[model samples]
Target: MAEQTTEQTCPQCGLDMPVDAGYPVWCTGCEWNVAPELFVYGLGGTAARRRELAGRHSEGTFEELAREGTRGRRARLTASYVLSYALALMVHGLSFALLGAGVGLLVAGGGNPVAWAVGVPLVLLFLVLLPRFPRLGSRVPRLERADAPRLFGLIDEVAGEVGTRGVDVIVVDGRVNAGVHTYGLRQRVLHLGLGLWAVLTPQQKVALLGHELGHFAGGDTRHGSVVGSALYTLRLWVEVLRPERWNGRVARVLVALPLTPPHHAAQSVLSLLEKVSLRGFPRREYLADDLAAEVASTEGARDLMETLLHAARIDDELHRLAADLSGPHETLWAQLADRVAAVPPRERERLRRVSALEWHQQDATHPPTHLRVELLDRRGPSTPKVVLDRRTEKAVERELRPSARRLARTIAQER
Candidate 1:
C-alpha cells in the first residue's frame, strides 16, 4: 500500500510538494531536492562537457523518435545507417592498410635490420588491433538441445514468432540480465541470467525471449559484424594508445604526452561511430518490444519491464546470497524470489518514479526504460501468439536445475 503523503515546502522554490514518508520530496517547478548525489566525480573539464553533449544528443534522439511515433522504421537503411557502415569499414580498412604496409616492407627489404625492426612491430600491432569475437567463457554452464528439449522447443517457438532463428547456444549465468549476440561466423548465443529468470512468471519469460530474439529479427546494427567489429577495433585502439600509470608527475607527463593526441583522436572517432550507429537504436528497441508484445501479449511485456525496475535489488540479493557461505546452497534461487517478492508496493512506486526521473536505461545503447514503457502503453493491448504453460515451465525448470545448482555451488565456493 502507498504511504500517506503530507504537504511540505520545498527549500529552493518554496513550492508545496507532497512528501511520502520514506521517499524523496522534490519541487516540480524548480526541480529542487532531486538526485543531488548522483553526479560522477572527477568529470570536471572536457569529460563533463562531453557527458553534457552526449546527454543532449540522447534527449534529442528520444524526442525525435518518440515524436515520429513508431512507424515502420524497423531495419530501414537510413542515411545514418549508411554513414555508420562507412565509418566501420574505414576503421577496418585502416587496420588492413597497416598490415599491408608492414608486409610490403618485409617483402621488399629482405635482409635489412631496419625492415625487420619496423615490420615486426607493425605486424604485431596489427595482430593486437584485430577485432575480437565474443566467446562463452569456459566457466559458464552451456545447455544443449538434447539436454533441454523443452527449453529449446520453447526457444524455437519464440524464435519463430519473432521471425529469427533460435540460438545455437544457451548459457546460464548468475547475472540479473539476459542478452543475445552473434560470435564466430554468425553463431547465435543467448545468455540467460538465473537471477532474473528465477523471478519471472512464465508469460514474462516468453516476453523476455521475444525481446531478445527480436533484436536479431529487427536487424539491430550494433549486433551486426560491420558496426560491431568497428566498435571493438576502436576500443582496442583506445586501449593501445592509453599510457600506463607512471610513478612521478614528470614520468607520467612524459609517458602521456605523446599518446594523448592519438588517444583523443581514437576516442573522438569511437564517439562519432557510436553516435551515428545509435541514431536508430531506440527505434530498433521499440520494434523488439513490439515483437515481445506480439509473442507474449502486451500485459506480459509490460510485466517484464516492471520486473526490470527491480534489477538493482535483485543484483544486491544475488551478491548477498553468494556471500552467505553458511546458507543452504539449494535454496539460493528460492530465497532470491522470496526477497524480490517481498519488496513493498511503496518501494515499487518509488522505483517507477525514479526510473522516469532518471531516464533509467539498461545500457548506453538502450533508450530510457520509462520511454519504452510509455511507448508500449501508447500502443495499447495485444493478444499473445505464444504462451508458457505450467507443464512446459516445470519441464524447463527441471532441465535448468542441474545448471543452476552448479552455478550456485560455484558462486558459494568463489565467495
Candidate 2:
C-alpha cells in the first residue's frame, strides 16, 4: 500500500509537480518533470516543507560545482586505489614468502619433514594461482582528424568552448552512447557511439558531444584512472579464486573451502567501495548536461533529452532489425535514423510517460531522463544556432555508413 506523502513542486521552475506514491509529476508551466523515486527526498511533508527540503541551488559554472560535489567521492576513490594496490602487493609478497619458506625448509631439512612436504605443494599452488591483470584489449577502433575532419572540428570547437585540450583520439564503435576515456597518464580518447549518432540530428549530436567534452573540462575523466584501475584489480583477485577454473571437481571443492574467505571479503569491500566512490556521478552528469545546454542550444538540449526518453524503445527496434538478417540490407543505418525521424507526436508523449516510470538509480553516472529533461527545461529555452541542413547531415551519414554496416553485419552474425 502507498503511504501519504507531501505535495512536491519543481525546485527549478516553482510549479506544482505533486508527489504521488507511484506516478511521476511534471510541471505544466516549465514542463519540468521527475520520477516518483525522487519523491523519497520529499516524503511526509507539507507543500511548504517539501519545497524547503527540495530547494534548488544556483546553476553556474558546472566545473566548480562538479569538483565541489565529488570531493568526498574522489577522496574515497583515492583510498580505494591504495587498498587495491596494497592487496596486489600482499598477494605478491605472500607468494614470494611461501616460495622462500618452502625452499629453506627443504634445503635445511627442518624439524617437521611433513611440514616441508605440505609447504612444497602450497608454494607451488600459490605460484600457479597468482592472478595476473589482463592485458588491455584493442578492440575498439579509433578516429582521427584526418579520417573525419568535420566531426573532429566540431569536437574541437566544443572542447574549446568548454576551455580544455581537445581529446587526443576519437574512438567510434557502434553503440548508443558516448563518453571520454583516459589512457596512460595524459592521453585521452573520446568514444562516440555511431548507433546513437545515427539516430540524432547533427545539432542534437553537438549537444551530446558538448556533454562528453564537459567531462574533460570538469576533470571527471582524470579521476577515472585510479578508480577504474581499482575496479579492475578487484576483478583480477576475484577471478583468481574461481574454483571452476581448477582441475577436478572434487579437488576444486577442497581448494575452494579456504579460498572462499578472501574471495567474499574482496567482493564485499569492492562492492561498497564502488558505490561510495561513484556516488557523486549523478551530480557530474548534471554538470555535463549544463555544459551541453550552455554550449549548444536549448532546443538542442530538448532534442537530446527527449531522444534519451525514446532511446530504449528505439534501441529495441534496432536490436530486432539487426536480428532479422533477411531484412533489407542496403540502407540499414538509414533505417535506424528513419525510425527516430518517424516517431509520431502522440507516440512520443506515450513513450515519455512510460519511460518516466524508470527513474530509479541504476548507477551513479546518470539520472533518469525525466529529471534530466526537467533540469534542461529549467534552463529556459535558448535559440541554438546549429544549422545542419539535410545536405550536411546526409554527408555526415555517408561518412559513418560503412562503420554502421559493419556493426549491423557483426550483430547479425552473432548467435
| CA RMSD of each candidate after superposition | 6.3, 9.2
Off by over 4 Å in 1: 1-73, 109-120, 245-265, 319-328, 342-347, 411-415
- Relative to the true structure, candidate 1 reaches a TM of 0.77
Q: Candidate 2: TM-score?
A: 0.64
In terms of lDDT, the best-performing candidate is: 1
Question: Against the true structure, candidate 1 has what lDDT?
Answer: 0.79
Count clashing residue pairs per candidate: 0, 0
Pairs that clash in candidate 1: none
**Once superposed on the true structure, which residue ranges of model 2 sit more than 4 Å away at CA?**
1-136, 184-186, 221-223, 247-255, 320-330, 358-364, 383-395, 412-415
Q: Write the per-residue lDDT of candidate 2 for residues 35-154, one digit (tens) a residue.
A: 343442332344335344431222232334434542122122344345544544554565567687777766777668787777787678567644333232477566666776666666
